[model samples]
Target: MTRTRVPALGAEGWFTLDAETPALLGDRCTACGSYAFPPAGSFCRNPRCASTAFATVPLSRRGKVWSYTDAQYAPPSPYVAPQEGHVPFCIAAVELAEEGLVVLGQVVAGVTVDDLQVGTEVEVVLDTLFSDEDHDHLIWKWRPVAAGGAG
Candidate 1:
């Protein structure tokens, strides 16, 4: 049986999956130039800017680690553990310098907090978060930037 590749239901409109280099989709406030993730809302989030227009845009694919930690325990409801059961993973808070935004994501599989540092550079990548008989639920993850700047 073939399983379909699909983004997690809650993540729709937050990213693009078909591009060679997939990117997170965000919305920039037309008035203030500030960006927001998940791309939802009719008005700008900036308190000083009253303008309501925004344009969907792709966010930076790379950023520096602002912080990171190990998740030794499984998450609560709505999170499905892998077939082998819960395995420890690392979570990172990466700061996109261009947007001045910090995004949180799981570290790519096989990488642990021991391999990362506060300022380590990382890039976004898509991977299976979990799977069902019919689908592989994909989600964004962070991986240390390879030498020479390739993601």
Candidate 2:
């Protein structure tokens, strides 16, 4: 199936992981060579650093699950949840070792609250959150990658 939703590519001419290629985009500090995922728009988020300089970088697709939880209830408004028949979903914080950062996102299709456990290794994927009468929103997701293989 093809998804029409187009997510926010990036803040300023940088590329984001979306359909066909799901990868986290980030920034690297020129001074200390530290990486920042989700691309710090204004300045470096590093506590010890005091520089605004950064360069675009792509994160590894594969990561280990740092933590996770299921949403038994629908998230509050402005969240864009389903209008009726609310269903529980899972969210996870994945740790990319190459970037040394944790990115939180939704789980991939066929993955449920029962199918997940802490510390499971997963790979990133692009998925659609929901499409209403007005818009279709694409978002990053993750699923268990096959052993020794990219998902």
Candidate 3:
């Protein structure tokens, strides 16, 4: 049976799934040229800039790992564990090459904290966060750029 793919609710405008490559949709300040993910709206996040105008732009795909950790405990409600139950997952803070901003996300499955190090090159990709009978809920994940980099 075929399942429909959908972004995890609340992730609609935060990323693009139509491109040859998946990209996070960020916003560039029209006045001071600053950038923010989750698309900074209403006002520029830059404290020095008072501009409220922004242009939606695709963010860079590659970055270097800034920090990482593992979630050994399952989160509270609203989070759905897989069929295998609550397994630990790695989380990484990656500094986007062009934006100079560190964005946090879950590392791809099968990768452990021991496999990552600060400065490790990584890239963003869309992955299934969870699956229901009719849909595959998706979200962005970080993966090491090198071959066999996952642990």
Candidate 4:
């Protein structure tokens, strides 16, 4: 039996799960060039800019680690743990160079706080959040970029 895939969190247009390289979807102000994650619609997020037009944009997949920490406790609602219960996980805030924005996500399974450092290069990858009999929920995660290799 195969389990269907789903987004663990109900965010539409936030990221793509079907691309060769998974990328976070963002909205860029056509007028001010400001970018926002979760793809802002209907308005420019830049306060100084009065334009409401936006273009859907794929965010940079690679970034430098800005900060990181371990989540030892189960997260609050909207996050569901597996049947085994809460497992410690590392979360990282990565700074995208072009956008100059920091996006937070969990590090790939098996990654830990000790395995990361500020300025370490990382790349976005799709990962399973949890699985049920009917579906395997997916989410974006960060992984250390292999040395001298493209992400």
TM-score of each: 0.92, 0.80, 0.90, 0.89
Model 3 TM: 0.90
Lowest-scoring 10 consecutive residues by lDDT in candidate 2? 8-17
Top-TM-score structure, candidate number: 1
Model 3 spans with C-alpha error above 4 angstroms: 148-151
Residues 49-81, candidate 3: write the lDDT tens digits: 999999999888889999999999997769876
| Per-residue accuracy of model 2 over 23-106 as CA lDDT, tens digit each | 777889988778876677668777898888888877898888889887878888667664476677788899888788898888
Find the candidate with the highest lDDT and give its number.
3
Give candidate 4 regions above 4 Å deviation.
147-151
Question: What are the RMSD figures for all models against the true structure?
Answer: 2.2, 3.7, 2.2, 2.5
Per-residue lDDT tens digits for candidate 4, residues 19-80, read 35889889999999999887779888788999989989989999999999998999887778
Candidate 2: segments with Cα more than 4 A from true spot: 1-4, 8-18, 147-151
Q: How does each model score on lDDT? A: 0.85, 0.72, 0.86, 0.85
The whole-model C-alpha lDDT of candidate 4 against the native structure comes to 0.85
TM-score of 2: 0.80
Between the candidate structures 1 and 4, which one is better when assessed by TM-score?
Answer: 1
